[model samples]
Target: MNNPSLISGTTFNEIFAIMEASFPVSEIRTFSGQRALLDNPNYQLFTEKDTEGKTLAFLAAWEFPELRFIEHLAVNPDIRGGGIGNKLMSSYIHRSDKPLLLEVEPPDGELEQRRIGFYERLGFQLNPYSYVQPPLRAGQADLPLRIMTYPQAVTLKEFQRFRDILYTEVYRITVPSSR
Candidate 1:
C-alpha cells in the first residue's frame, strides 16, 4: 500500500524528480531555493512513498502560528490517478492545527477548473480576492493567482494580507533580481 511520509535529505532527489515531472522547471524553483526558507522555522516537506519506499508525492508548506500556507504540491506522473495526491493533502490538513491556505491559478480554462476542482474536493474553498502573482521570470507576464483556504473561510482583506506577506517574504527571498 502507498503511504505518506515526511521528506528528508535522503529523499530529496526522488522528491525533485516528482516536482520536475509535475511542473515546469521555472515553476518548480522551490526545489532549488528551499534552503533560503529553511531557517524560516515554518518550512516543512511531506512525501508519500510506495511499499518499496520510493517517494511518489510531495507537499511543501510554511506554517505560521495561526495559519499554514501550502507552497508546493505534486504527485509522480506514474502514480497520478491513484489516491496519492489526496492522501498527501489529507495528511497535511490533519496535522495542521490552524487554517490552511494555498494559491492556485484562476479558472481561466479547463485545466484551471480541473485544478480548482481537485483542491475543492479536498475541502478547500476559494477566497473571494483577486491577486496577480509576480512573473515567474523577469520578462514573463504576471499571472492571475487565486487564494484558497481550507476549513476556515477567509475574507478578501485577509487574503490580500497573505498575498502581500508571500510576495515580500517568500518571493523576495527566492527570486533573484534581474541584472
Candidate 2:
C-alpha cells in the first residue's frame, strides 16, 4: 500500500478503471474529479497489487486529525472474495488508532446486508442516523446512506460533527443541517 506518495500514470488509470466498475456513477466522481483528488493533501489512495504489479484492489480515504473517512473501497470484481479486502482494511485499521468511519448503503437488501455484516465482523458499528451523503459531483442528488464506525458507536453529537467535517472537507460543499 503506497502512502504519502500519490498514484499516477498507468497506476492511476488502472485504479480508476476498478473504481468505475465497482461503484455506481451517483456514488463516484467523474474521472477528472477522481484524478484531481490526488492533489488534496488529506486524501490517500491505497492499492493492493498482485505479483505482476497490477492493481487488484484499492481503498480511497481521507485522513483527518480525529477521523479517518473511508470514501471508497473495492476489490477487483473478477478476483474478489479472496480475503484481500479484509487484509487491506485490517492493515489500514492497524495503521492508526484514530477513530475510523465509513459510509455504506442501508441494509434494505441481501447484498447491502451482507456488506454491513462484513463490516460488523470487523468490529464496525452501524450507526442509525438520518444520514444523507452529499453528492460527489454536480447534478447528483444527496444519497441516503448509513455510517459505520470502528472501535465504538457514535453519539448524535459525534455523528453531527463528523457529518459537518465530511461535508466541509470530503464533499467540499455544505447544506442545511439535517435535524
TM-score for each of the candidates: 0.82, 0.96
Please, what's the RMSD in Å of model 1?
A: 4.7
What is candidate 2's CA lDDT for residue 26? 89
Find the candidate with the highest lDDT and give its number: 2
* Model number with the top TM-score: 2
lDDT by residue for model 1 over 1-179, one digit each (tens)? 12223345657778777777887645556545654454566677777777787888888787776678897889989778888888888888998578888888888899889989999998999877777767544456666778889886687667766666677665663433330
lDDT of each: 0.74, 0.90
User: What is the clash tally of candidate 1?
Assistant: 0
The residue-by-residue lDDT of candidate 2 on 1-179, one tens digit each, is: 77636586788898899999998998999999998899899999999999998989999999999899999999989999999999889989889999999999999999999999999999999999989888887988999999999989999999989988898999887647663
Alpha-carbon lDDT of model 1? 0.74
Worst 10 residues of 2 by lDDT: 1-10
